[model samples]
Target chain A: MFSNDSQIGDFVKSAPKPKNEKERLAALKRLEILDTLPEQSYDDITKIASYVCQAPIALVSLIDGDRQWFKSRVGLDATETPRDIAFCAHAILEEELFYVPDSSKDERFADNPLVTGHPNVAFYAGAPLETAEGHRLGTLCVIDNKPRVFTDEQKDILTMLSRQVTQLLEYRVINENLKRETKIAKTMTRFFENSQDLMCVAGTDGFFKEVSPSFTEVLGYAVSELLGRPFLDFVHKDDIALTIKEVGKLAQGHRTVNFQNRYQTKDGRWLILSWTSSPSADGSTIYAIARDSTVEIQKQNELLKSYEEIKATRAELVRPKEEAIEASNAKSRFLANMSHELRTPMNAILGYSDLLIEEIDSSQPAVIEDVKKIKSAGDHLMRLINEILDLSKVEAGKMGVSRDTFKVAEVIGQVEGLVRSLIGKNQNKLAFDISKAPAAFNTDQEKYKQILINLISNSAKFTKSGNICVRVFEDNAAGVALMVTEISDSGIGIPTDKLESIFSEFSQVDESTTRLYGGTGLGLSICRKFADILGGKLSVKSELGKGSTFTLRLPSLAAKKSKSSSSQAPSKKGSKRAA
Target chain B: MKRVLVIEDNEINQDLIARRLVKKGYKVDFAIDGEKGLQLIESLQPDIVLLDMNLPVMDGWQVAEASKVNPKTKHIPIIALTAHAMAGDREKTLAAGCDEYQSKPIVFDELMKKIEKCLGSV
Candidate 1:
């Protein structure tokens, strides 16, 4: 009487339209289920049922107002089917079992669209699905792509499991309906009362519906104070436009995550906010959460400040090295050019001075005096050039030091001989207070002699017509002390304030003293450098209107020899060969 | 009078040294450069040569080498005059065939001593 192509109620033309149509409608309506997202609990049951029944497909079908919808399905990807054509609709018409052992051969199913095509109900069986109230809504069914048979025992098991599915559906309808109402109320309460973050529900029109206590704690405003106000009223004026734009996105079903902004507190202080928000139903109410981010923002600001400082210090540090290199290069270039210029002129002076001294008659006093003056000037000029070159070499870090064991007294005698003429000419009384210097100390005798001569000359030049004192003393522990004093009527004492910087290169007590004394300001600087090279320090103590005392303290030769290699023979040979 | 050749580029230095040698009872010949000095030594056959290390045209080292090569001039003593007192300069001059070397701002007494030593050696 029925073709496979006919739908569930199609057989109703011959059989009185299965008695519980009204009751089935009531059961489907009471379930109140349609168009819901898949739940894992229901989906897992369908998967277990298909595995147990050894069927490839299983579904929890709920008959809705106008459709048979799947809450969950194991093999099907669709959500709903038209109620008029649903097979589960016919399965629900049966009392105990509705089974089609060979759907392809069955007169009722052979020509059915679903049986002939996909889902191809070639073998089928179903148990009537019912609620606890005895309302049959759908079926729990197994389907096969080919013809199959089911024993009576398999039919009993299918009916029992389908009855369990119906009970679960009834229980879920009652329980979830209560849960939905209660969850909505609790979510609304949590949106205001118990959140750690300052949360709020605001309308799309910018009015606040609710706010959490954390809002009052963080912003110093009560819920009542903010409830009726436009949300923009609490927003910092500078942040209002941005806040409006972000709020607009939330109303369009888009959620804003970590959208930071600022708000004005009741006391007019700005509070920084890191906020996230989403739109509720009707797209009118905005659910938002906010954290006070001012501390993090301050830290960010401090980090940026430190970064800028580091950049400045990096530039500052790099500039000096470049400048030092440039200055050294400039000095080197100047020295090379100056050596050529000055040497050429010095050649003439030395050569002519030598010749003039020899040519001048011993009998003629004026000619001898003229030769003497020329020789003196030439000697002075040569000394100046030598000093300049030596200082340059020291500055360039190329000055060579030769250590040798020579008698201190012997060096003193050499200096005396060299300056014998100057001493006699100056008529300055010379006094020597030698401790007889501890049995002739061994040192770099040449450098010691050079230092002595410089010191003596300075003393003699600065002082006039007074006793010049030279003293040599020794300590068993500390090395040696050579002191020179030139007492004079001039009374040009170095001031106390400028004494500390006096030993520095190119520094003098004052410009007036420099002008009067006529010095290159390199003597004391050279002395200090030499003392430092010898592992000693040179210092000065002075008082205004009183003579300054300069002290040079150096390690003795014994210490130096212990520290360095005992290679005096080669060094002496080198120095003598150089001279 | 013993003959002496003074090789130097500076006019003032040449005039002064020549006049001095003349007064000192020597017949002095002047050469403005090392090449001229070599030519003068070849022609005049002076007893001694006072050579300046820094000279125009040909320097003292080349003149020394040339003088040592010539058998006749090789008999004559040469004293090197240098203003650069750098290390190894004395050995450099001596290695160039100078009999003696002296640093300049030349104290006449020192130069006289070296010159006499060179003369006595030759």
Candidate 2:
């Protein structure tokens, strides 16, 4: 045993126990300083502690559970010791300085390992290292192998040095946290700058507080130029009111998603943006992401414009066609009205002529002949009116075809009976060559008869003494059988140049033909139209002076009437019948 | 002799119809317009009435309606004669209560056949 001292008696005999040992240990663990490498800052504190106390050994120790780990040490080879033997562990339980000035003579350290082991015969002093929350983590302590005593001034200096050590630990913990937070912030900033979407933070005053690099790239403006400007200043004039309204919602702590607006870029072009924005928790700022939709909007506008243009062009094209149809319908109405007017007078002239002729004596040939001449002239005028009306109906596309199944021979017989007198009047012979004729045909019977009558009468007017041959046959061409009626005449033939024109409305072979024949020139044209209405064709083959043959070809099957004329019945009991 | 009433506005058409009927040994009475024709229907009490549509004051449809409604004249046959010989005119005139229909510039033979048929029916 060494010399006894009252200072060692004043020191607590064993380690002092704190009420919250677990919490104190947790505070020590939170420092993350146990068994760390000796940092210069901590080592500097321990060196100062040792010099001020005039001790041979010094340490910055963190007392962990069941162990004391040294963060920094001077004149000590060991970095750790058992907590039960550690002077620093006992120091952590006290609120003030702990001293064991003559470990061999002090009852607390009399049998301690450090008292009799290597670096023994120790004297010790420790200032408890406490955090800002008053949790004692460990100690900044000094020790000597020989007995020693500390004055009040040295104890105070050691207390101040221990406080400095506590400050360094707290600073290191805060600095480490700062470094980690800065790394995370740097990563987030990189993400914001590299994104293609326009990311922005705006103050409640509607000015941009911060903008990502994408904002500059998309708006063609520098980041400096766009910052501090009201976001509405860059919006399209027409869109400003709506943009203000949407921003007002954000200021009111409402989140807006996919709100669209047009923004004008620095280049004076409009960029369409779809925005999703949310207000900050304090409602002082808004965070937003925008997608540029200018190209998509332009494409939609182009498609709408083209559709409108197509609609307008269609209306423009349809007007003339409708007007033309109306005009043609008016002409047809006028012709029908005029025919009614003309037929009235013609009825009077022909009827009175017949009456007058009956009233006169048969002996006076001159007077009787004059009345007959009046009758003939009136009949001729009636024929002219009828032809004009027929042509009008055909031209107006209002001619109707009345289909009925009839005997071919019966139709031929009727045609022959009707034209027999005309052929006789022309001093011509009529021959019917119907060897290959079908027994029955399904077609428009009236149109068939009209075609035959027009052709035979045309031949009778031209031929005086020649034979007129009427041939009827079935032609199976193009996989469909057609009924072909050929009327050939050894008459004054049409010239090749005039043949095509002959089928045109009111067209005769020549003016001389009209004068000599005393016939309405609409005969062949009406016939052609009738054939067409029945889904047939009427064509003519002629030479200059030898002969002419008119062929009428009709489909063997009856065609359904066209919709335009299906409601109209072929006129019966009118001037058309007079023809 | 069967009696016939000719309702025609045009002077020539009236004269022509009258002469034709007189020549056929039928007694004929004349009215210049449909109003007069309606009056004459009671007075003449003809065997048949020839009503011409498109008259000056009262048209044929009115005259036909007026006469057909009268118990005294409704039994007498009325034939519609019209210069308005469009396709639908026949049905239109008949629908107005005419017993028969004829078109003008009248085919005298067909008219005579219709007149005889009307006269023979009653």
Highest TM-score, which number? 2
- Give the clashing residue pairs of candidate 1, or none: A3-A108, A4-A108, A4-A109, A4-A112, A5-A111, A5-A112
Candidate 1 iRMS, in Å?
A: 3.8
Per-candidate TM equals 0.48, 0.59
For A296-344, candidate 1 gives per-residue lDDT tens digits of: 9989989999999999999999999999988996796677458657866
User: How close is each model in CA RMSD to the real structure?
Assistant: 15.6, 10.5
lDDT string for model 2 (A11-36, tens) is 33446557888888787777777766
Docking class of 1: acceptable
Off by over 4 Å in 2: A1-39, A42-322, A333-381, A394-397, A407-414, A417-421, A433-441, A473-482, A510-518, A556-579, B1-18, B26-106, B109-122
Best model per lDDT: 2
TM-score of chain A of 1: 0.47
